[model samples]
Target chain A: MTQTLGITVDNISVTYSNSRLALYNASCYVQPGSITALVGPNGGGKSTLFKSIMGFLEPNQGQVDISGLPIHKAQKKQLVAYVPQADEVDWNFPVSVWDVVMMGRYGYMNLFRIPSSKDRRLVKESLTRVDMMDFKDRQIGELSGGQKKRAFLARALAQEAKIMLLDEPFTGVDVKTEKAIIDLLLQLKDSGHTILISTHDLASISTFCDRVILLNQTILASGKTEAVFTEENLAMTFGGIPTIRNEERGTRNKEEKISTIGFD
Target chain B: MILDWITEPLQYGFMVKALWVSAFVGIVCAVLSCYITLKGWSLMGDAVSHAVVPGVVVAYALGIPFAVGAFLFGFGATVAIGYVKENTRLKEDAVIGVVFTGFFAFGLVLSTKIPSNIDLFHILFGNVLGISQEDIIQTLIAGFITLLVILLRRKDLLLFCFDPNHAKAIGLNTKFMYYTLLLVLALTIVTALQTAGIILVVAMLVTPGATAYLLSDRFERMLAISVGTSLLSSILGVYSSYYLDAPTGACIVVLLTLLFIAAMIFAPKYGLLRRSHSTIESN
Candidate 1:
């Protein structure tokens, strides 16, 4: 197998143009070929970290790299793919699902962005993988919330990038769609793709994610899911965990051999 | 009578020139309008279009190329808007509204103060009927370049407009895309100013695209439909202006507005008529 490309964020800090400090000396390493959940509350700098890793927002303090390469260089090599939050998209855009999925192959396409035969095949395969082939020609805005997330997931899949960053993929999706997405991420992990997903859905973390990063403008904890997803870390990240523990009581799995993180 | 309605305007030299210039300008404006409209930058288009008036007045005073002055000032207005939006708590629409009106008022003041035979009425409303050969050349060049750039960079620009974060993550220079879009918008306004003037140019840039948006579900189709609406309106507006003895710019804008209203009501899937029909049937 080719050398696995993992994400490394080193002491990065981000401050928005509005003088709001979004991240402060934050650092973490996503192991190659693993699923890492960045669990944080709303406005906890998860999106900021994703943007920093994607080279969209330059850090005020430090650097981010993918597989020991500078972020921009990694991006040019098509080493990363990102699925932005639904709120970041203009749903009323005129592009069809096929058009949006086809954008994933743009890095491989030439200046005019005419798709090659391979590009076309990959787009079709990725859409079919996400079960969105039936809606390929439909306008993107016509899809359900879950379907829109799947369409964007299909876009990320089509990029064939080594590292995938998804921001709040579970926010608006149904339970079944969420399971399907998690299963897909597992398949990607097994294939040596490094994946980082930021979400507030704590219940699913222990089931499939190999690692968890508890964050609230800074890293509260970072390690294997069982070791780092403790109640104390959760409380620190969420500013008190009474509601989380109450919800966790109802959904604790029957097989308690492995420590499970749940707060639904 | 139909044949004369078509051929009568073709006989005049100025009419033929106006037709060619407006056709070229219409296509450019229509194409760029799709990006402007979809990106929710209609107010940005308004800001830039109005901001060019001062540049044109100054260009006339300095005997420089109108495009240069117009682009500089139009681009300056966008910069000013960006600066204010970044620094202030005010929203984007408010910033755009403030800056454009300020630039336009400055131009109005300057035009009144400047000692020249420049027709303030023509600057405000356009003089397509009295267009010069030099203006035709300038319009064609600006329109051609704008069209070519958009054609080549269509996908990147589309991605940037639709989801800039995704565009950035995929290694596209989104900052470049942003600036390039603004630059093209300024150029499009310059091409449109000669045909539609300061006040009506924003309408020319908005109506065709919005009409096509109502009529089509896909981007490529949207482009084709907008270009069709614009080309037809330009030809018909110029021809009807000859017979009706009206200002050509107002005639073009009126026709485009009428077409937009028609599309809003009568478009196949998204039209108000179809929506109402579907509601009635469901009941």
Candidate 2:
């Protein structure tokens, strides 16, 4: 029997301690082997949804099932690897790039057991995949912003997880590093790894993503990249605010325009 | 020089006992502080050290071995800080500040009210010269146990410190690891109080680890460097205090501070002075 990398969200909702509802009755299914870009304005519940899926937060009213296992269950966490925003880590922490990547294997290795030769090899391979092998011995604090993000990506890649949830992986990264990361994600998708990334860069959405999930407190729309990027849908998803402008028009206009664009 | 110092100290049984006790405390605090410094819990040492004062005062008032009272009080303070940090919006440092200051102030008030026979200065600044043989053996046993526990759980403790999220995702009990670390820290601080005193215990807990951090990125190397620095500083400080008629705890802390400053200037990689020099050379 063929196995499916499935993510089934059933009526999930979340409310912060200050009594603000971050998510409300949101539901979506992530199909296997695809890049799904979750895009929205800041504080629009994108990160909250990703955390909920990773079982970091208990939904106030719904369930997330991944590969037949519930989010809260320990077995399900093994199937999903999460790359949190790089800014969340303390760079002053005394550790090398290799050490950080080795942490990815912690989920598979025995909790008290030392990493074996195989684990070391996997760390090296992951670093090499990110083209960071030359700087393996360098401390995390010594790396640039883009390098730090790539190192985190290598750490997630080393987890060998079936599904990867990345939050703002391309934020503040230079275009070259961003393209390299997107290329790596594309390769991973081709290799049957389900990838979901939360991002704000609408320009790269069509080029890098196979599908787009536009969320604003709830799932406004989710479908093929071309179908979901319509001007009307973008305005609705962004709270009736237009985000794109044609430079050829020379001046700003509030009038809505529908344009067909190919992936760059 | 080593033989001369060893023989002269061994001639006086008390000196020999003091040296052994200091060594024991040095080893225990050195190993335990590696974890504390790495996890950014260096300030917890200061909290526990000051928290023990009230326990020591109460025990002295009751005419008992002060270690029992101090252990209970120090461990209680640690737990209180952990509890408040978990249950309230207060940060860890704020919780520690409230808990330690309350206990320390209570101890200070009690010291002033109690009989003049017990010297308040002696309690605050420990007298390594007056260490009893029983104290030496007790500290050795505690140190051995602390070392064994650290060695056995080194991997788990390291994982918890570096990345707790990954530790949890791996099915490791992160809460258990955190509390276990606090317990070890409390025990280590209580043990070191015998030799370094409450005022200087933080020096033993923080200085050597911080010095090691400047020198190495590998955890194992850092542990070794910290332990070595602690041992060397303890012996040198004790000998210098004996010869120069200085306060032992102060002498030890001063020596540790000097070593830390030297490492900050001389060590490669993360050292500030070294980095500046390298930058100049590159330019």
For each candidate, give its TM-score against the true structure.
Answer: 0.91, 0.85
The per-prediction tally of clashing pairs is 0, 0
For model 2, the superposed segments whose C-alpha errors exceed 4 Å read A1-4, A8-27, A57-63, A75-77, A144-146, A172-176, A239-264, B1-7, B57-69, B107-120, B278-283
**Tens-digit per-residue lDDT, B122-174, candidate 1:** 87888888987787777777788898899899888988888887777778788
In terms of docking quality, model 1 is: medium
**lDDT of candidate 2 over A1-264, digit per residue (tens):** 234776888899999766799999999988888999998878889999998887777889999887767654533256777788876687777778988888888777764667889889899899999999999988898999889988988888888888888999988799999999999999999999999999988888899798888899999888888998777888888865543434533363434222322221
lDDT digits (tens) for residues A1-264 of candidate 1? 244598888999999877899999999999988899998888989999988988877889999879888888788888999998989887888889999999999888888899999999999999999999999998988999999999999999999998999999998999999999999999999988999999878888899999998889988789899999988888888987868766765777666524444432
lDDT by residue for model 2 over B1-283, one digit each (tens)? Answer: 8888667767887677677677778778888877899898888889988998888888878876677678788889988887888678776788899999999999899888876455677768887888666655656665676787788888778878877866655456777888878777777876787788888999999999999888887777888888888888888888878888898888888888898998998898778888998899999
- Could you give the C-alpha RMSD of every candidate to the true structure, in order shown? 5.2, 5.3
lDDT of 2: 0.82
| Pairs of colliding residues, candidate 2 | none
What is candidate 2's DockQ? 0.35
The TM-score of candidate 2's chain A against the true chain A comes to 0.89
| Per-prediction interface RMSD in Å | 1.6, 2.8
Instruction: Name the best candidate (by lDDT).
Output: 1
